[model samples]
Target: MQFTIIKYEIIVVSFVALLIFLLIGIAYLTLLERKFMASIQRRRGPNVVGIFGLLQPIADGVKLIVKETILPSHSNTLVYVLAPIFTFFCSLVLWLVLPFGQGHALYDFPLGLLYILAISSLSIYGIIFSGWSSNSKYAFLGGLRSAAQMISYELSMGLVLLCVILVSGSFHLGSIIESQVYSFHSVTLFPIWIIFIVCILAETNRAPFDLPEAEAELVAGYNVEYSSLAFALFFLGEYANILFMSALSTILFLGGYLPIIELIPLPGILWFTVKCLLHALIFIWVRATFPRFRYDQLMKLGWKYLLPLSLSFLLVESSILIIINPY
Candidate 1:
């Protein structure tokens, strides 16, 4: 009984620590985006708040917290309030099964990859609820767009994941990482990696695929009615999802937590974080480089291009695995 209680205590503490770390990461990710984008555009970013604007995110958080949360009088208050919370919760919980190093995850479920796919799909409900609750035409249209976009891209993403799983022969993320000990998937599955990158970019609603929040037409989109802390919640949730996708990309292609050269010993977690950051930088770079896709263009790319490419990769990968293993 005592041992069980201690184990539960450890789990709770670990969860709290992970939550705090992720919140900090989300905050700094916004700062990094602003600074990087500003550099690309040849302008000053948040350097006024602190040394190199290191404390800018904290100031922004303070400002958002003090501002009054304005609720639309016509909005469904209950669902309006719950939507951001639900989205934020889903974004955070997906990390529970993501391994930072060997044996380092919280749950480490056998079907961790499938669990991620399932929970990520649930996040759309929050978006739909927020848009519908706002009772605004613009918000409702944005919500509908997000639903179609996510559903379209998720099929491609799932097929890409299946390709990885087939190569690894295990649904467990750790096993997938181990399967890459001799060589990374990025080499063998280069085309699939490229396709997965595009799929994840759309899945996270990042630029080129950011139709759901397009400023020109949607006018800030589904969360237009939100203000203050509520708005902040949506903002944080979006960035968190972006970082999660980056981590997923790192794990699937870059070999999670594996060092580049085994000859020089180093920590696995450090390599994992470095690879994840590189993927995050790719996301930010794409945002700076590409214009937002036309909504029809976005759908066409997902359904017409990405879906077929992913299916082809999966079939080839399965054939290769069967030939190699012959079991």
Candidate 2:
């Protein structure tokens, strides 16, 4: 009984630590995205808050907290109150299965990958509820778009993940990383690695796949009616989901916590962070460089292009393994 209590306490403490890290990362990611986008557009971004806008996120947080939470006259009061909370909680829960470094994961569940996919799929509900409960046309349209887009892309993303499971032969994230680690004489498997990165970007709703929040059509999508701290929660959840997806990509494809070159002797966590940041940077870069697709184009690309490609990759990988073993 005493040991169980200690274990529970440890788990709680670890979850709290992870929450802090995620919140900090989300704040900095907003700053970093603005900074990067500013440089690309030949302008300064957020320079006044602190040294080169280092404290800008904190200032923004304070402002949001102090602002009024205005409830719309026609809104469903109960769901209006609950939508952002649900969205924030869903995003936060994803970190439980994410492995940060060697022996650093919260739980080593055998079905970790499937568990993450399930949680992510469920997060769309929060967006739907927020939009519908707001009782505004813009909000309703935004919510409908988000639900359709997420469902469409999620299918392709799942197919891509199915390919990874085929190649690695396990749903455990740590095992997937171990499969990617280089041995003495064999050549590294590069094909699976490439597919994993592409899938991660799509799964996270990064551009060229950000149809859910396309400003041209939905005017900020499902959270259109949110303001002040309520809006902040949605913003935080979106960026946190980005970070979580990037971290998951690092773990599954780029060899989580493993050094890229293997010659350098850096710590595992350092490698993991660097890899995640690079992935995040790529996401931002795509947003800056590419234009959003038409809704039909986006749906076509996922269903027609990515799905079949992922399935073929799985088939080819299976054939290679059979020929190599022949028994």
Candidate 3:
């Protein structure tokens, strides 16, 4: 049927567009971090490649692609090669459920949030695979640290998300944004949002919590044995995850695609982007400001502090919701 052909065409086009956008976004996020850190350190980050180093990422990509991909002599070749590919794929796929703007997702299933959580949990496997396949003690140790770190923080992140889901009474991301339009639960429950965002930082293994790749301790951590294109894939995946988490934060806490003021006429996507960027900058800023947490310190924070607080808040939010709409 002509209609079916057209639908397929649309799907293909959208997929290509999304893929290109994600790659470009990841490329530039690298530049953004460099530029930001440069500013903090009172130096220029990149200024040679193309107008203010605009083409640096492109150049970097080319260099990585042209360089040799070294496989460790004793490594499990297939799994070692597949590790970064798996990491990159897992990072890119989660966008399918993420609503960029109202009705903007490639597929907006009712339980899209659950899909994201599940996929996020899967990313740890890639790290574990990379570490184990390397046959290097350093890489293996780094991967173990990252795995334990992610698992611990994920519990708290789930609790926070559960509270938001209960408050909105929907697992649909669009519905969650819509729920925010009037009540602004993110604002009313600011403390919970704070805890949620910090847990996110840990979940994503950002600074102060970046134990997985702690340079001084683990010599670049889980992907340490990777080189050239394989390493590039890990790099791309990491930045993509950062942006993805920022976008998720926007949806859950910052009112996704919603205007700061009703009177302002702006595209919802633009508002969504600005919010996402703000969340992203927090990731970068934290990296610049905080030193890495000791592994024990990090675990204690997640278990002793965040988990209990989020659980208590979840119960309180549920009780209040029940009282308000007891039908």
Candidate 4:
């Protein structure tokens, strides 16, 4: 039917547009991080390639693509190659369910949060595979560290998510954003929001929590053996996840697409973007500010500290909701 054909065409076009938009965002995020760090260190960063290094990310992509992909002689050829591809794929697909603004998400699922959590948890496999297939001890150890680190924070993050879901009373992401009636921060649950933000920093492996790729310790961690395009994919995937985490935090706690001031008038998408960018700045700032944690210290913080705190809050939140609503 002509209608069916039109629908299919729309789908294809939308997907292509989404892919382009996401890739461009990730590329600029790289540039943003460099420029931000440069400001902190009091130097110019990436200024030569184009106007203020606008084209630097594109040049970097092309350079990586042009370089030779060196496969380790003893590496498992299949999984080693597949690892970064898998990681990049998972990272990109997560954006599908994220609501950019009211009704503007590419795909709106009822349980979008659950979908994100499930997809994100699978990322560890890619890292583990990359490390194991490389046949390098450092890579293997780095992968192990990542696995353990992610699992630790994932527990706390899940609990954090539960608090949001409890407060919002909807699993749908758009509904959660809509529930935020006012922006700036959650009116009643600001502490939970703050905890969730911290949890996401660890979830995305930003600094203070970047043990997996601690340069001085793991020597670039699990992706060390990856060169050229493979390495580029891994790099892009990490940043993509970072942006997604920021977006998620915005949606959950910062009031997605909502203007901070009740009187302010701005397009919903612009507000959403500004909120996401602010969160992204926090991510880069944390990276610039904090020292990397000792591996044991990281585990202890996640387990002994964050996990219990999130759990206790979740329990308290649930009990309060029940008492208030009891009929």
Question: lDDT of model 3 at residue 185?
Answer: 59
> Candidate 1 residues 21-91, lDDT tens each?
98899899989999999999998999998899999999999999999999999999999999999999999
User: Candidate 3 lDDT, tens digit per residue, 1-327?
Assistant: 999899878867897899998899889888998999899989999999999999999999999999988999999999999999999999989988888788888887899889999999999999999999999998999999989999998998899889889888899999999989875656877888899788889877789898999889899999899999999999888888999999998999888988888898999999998988898888988898888889899999999999999899988988988899998
lDDT of 2 by residue, 29-93 (tens): 98999999899989898999999999999999899989998989989989987999999999999
What candidate 2 gets wrong by more than 4 Å, as runs, is 183-199
Judging by lDDT, tell me the better candidate of 2 and 3: 3
Q: Give per-candidate clash totals.
A: 0, 0, 0, 0
Question: In terms of TM-score, which candidate is strongest?
Answer: 1
Full-model lDDT, candidate 1: 0.92
Model 1 lDDT-worst window of ten = 313-322
Assess the local accuracy of residue 206 in candidate 2 as a C-alpha lDDT between 0 and 100. 67
Off by over 4 Å in 3: 1-5
What TM-score would candidate 2 get against the native? 0.94
Sorted on TM-score, highest at the top, how do the candidates line up?
Answer: 1, 3, 4, 2
lDDT of 1 at 24: 97
Worst 10 residues of 4 by lDDT: 182-191
Query: How high is each candidate's TM-score?
Result: 0.98, 0.94, 0.97, 0.96
TM-score-wise, the better of 1 and 3 is 1
Runs of candidate 1 exceeding 4 Å displacement: none
User: Which residue pairs come into collision in candidate 3?
Assistant: none
Better of 1 and 2 by TM-score: 1
